[model samples]
Target: MKTEPDAFSLEDLRQRGREPWEGIRNYQARNFLRGMRIGDGVFIYHSRVAAPGIVGTAEVVTTAYPDPTQFDPQSKYYDAASSLARPRWDLVDVAYRHTLAKPFPLERLRALPEFADSPLVRKGNRLSIVPITANQWDRVLQPAR
Candidate 1:
């Protein structure tokens, strides 16, 4: 999932071990989070940085649940329309797996035929979470290995 380093970096995830993947306001991204099952693989991507790329991997430790931030008025992600009875946002718990041997820069990924169809390579595609096929996943980590 793509996150700005200023908000949460791969190093921060490693230190924390696990954390709730939260603050997703987009409906499409929220659906992606909801679809995640335990043990699902995630590419921890750093976006909006000088060298944006996938820097590590993480595993889904928990299935989707209500994002608590949506209920807290003080939170930036709080939704006035969201209620405890029916939350508008959902999140999953993710545990740090391992950092890639090298960051897979977006430029390189775009040039690879394996990822030519990836949403990440599409201009103006800003969904934080996107599904990757098994083949695509393997191709992405191959270079890092």
Candidate 2:
């Protein structure tokens, strides 16, 4: 999933070992979080940085649950309309897996034939979480091949 490196980097996840992937406000992104199952793989993407790209990998450690931040009034991600009885946001804990030997730059990702139809490479597609095919996942993990 995509995050600003300053807010939460791959290094932060590596240090923490695992953390709740939270603060998603968009309905589409929220749905993606809900759809995640334990052991699902995730690409740790750093966006809005000097060089935006996928840098690491992670795996879901927990099923989707209510995001506590959405219930807190002080949190930037808080939703006034959300209630504990029926939370509007959900999160899944992701554990650090591995950091890529070399960062897969966005420019290279866009040029890859495997990602030609991916939402991640599509212009104006800003969903933090996007579904990728198994082929695309393998390509990311073994880009040199």
Candidate 3:
């Protein structure tokens, strides 16, 4: 049994520079935040666009914090009533690593017997953030190895 890697698009990462962390309205994604520990590995993914796959790696920079978007009524992710006193969601800080020479494209993952059964590469499953097992982590990175 393997949990898949969560993917982040290039645009989303660029947004990080502007807003830090925002637009995560889902609780599961939020939970990933709450559970995240500093130095945790991240598989930077490209989603909601053409050519999605693991493009780079990221490192957790900070522990969970109240998501400011939940407090801003004007913001899209705003929870309307959440506040510093009682926050609803949280997020972690992640920094980008150098891009992969050959992105572990979705096709490649599906072709491999090991990754074929992976939850991340499977169709009809889209989780903004997924947990990567120690072994699964090695597989994606093996190509670069």
Candidate 4:
């Protein structure tokens, strides 16, 4: 999942150990969070920085649940349309796994053969939670292997 480093960095997850990944307002991104299963691996990407890249990894520790932020008027992510019975947003808790020894820069990943068809590498694609193919996953972890 992608986040602005200033808002939430890989270090933040490491310090907290685990966190509820909330505030997902996009329908497509919300669906991806809902589809996550316990123990599933996730790449932690730092976006909107000088050097955007995958900084670390995390593990899904909880299945999908309604994001409380969507119902809280105090929250910036709050949606008035969302209700207790029919929530419009969902989130999953993820635990820190490891920080990559060397972060995978977006520029490098875009040039790789494995990511040729990945939405992550496509120009103008802005989906925060993207599905990575098995091959692409392996390639991303190859350096750490």
- Number of clashing pairs per prediction, in order: 0, 0, 1, 0
lDDT of 4 by residue, 8-40 (tens): 999999999999998888899988888888988
lDDT of 3 by residue, 1-145 (tens): 1112244354455556422445666777778778888888877776654566777677778888987778877877888667788888887767665457777777777787777566778788756777777676778787654
What shift in Å separates residue 67 of candidate 4 from its native position after superposition? Answer: 0.3
Better of 2 and 4 by TM-score: 2
Give TM per candidate: 0.96, 0.96, 0.79, 0.95
Better by TM-score, candidate 4 or 3: 4
Assess each prediction's global lDDT (C-alpha) against the native: 0.92, 0.92, 0.68, 0.90
Query: Order of all candidates by TM-score, from best down to worst?
Result: 2, 1, 4, 3
Instruction: Write the residue-wise lDDT of candidate 2 on 34-65 in tens digits.
Output: 88899999999999999899998999999989
Residue-wise C-alpha lDDT for candidate 1, range 35-134, written one tens digit per residue: 8999999999999999999998999999999999999999999999999998899999999999988899999889988888989889999999998889
Residue-level lDDT for 54 in candidate 2 = 92
Which residue ranges in model 2 land beyond 4 Å of their true spot?
143-145
Candidate 4: clashing residue pairs, number: 0
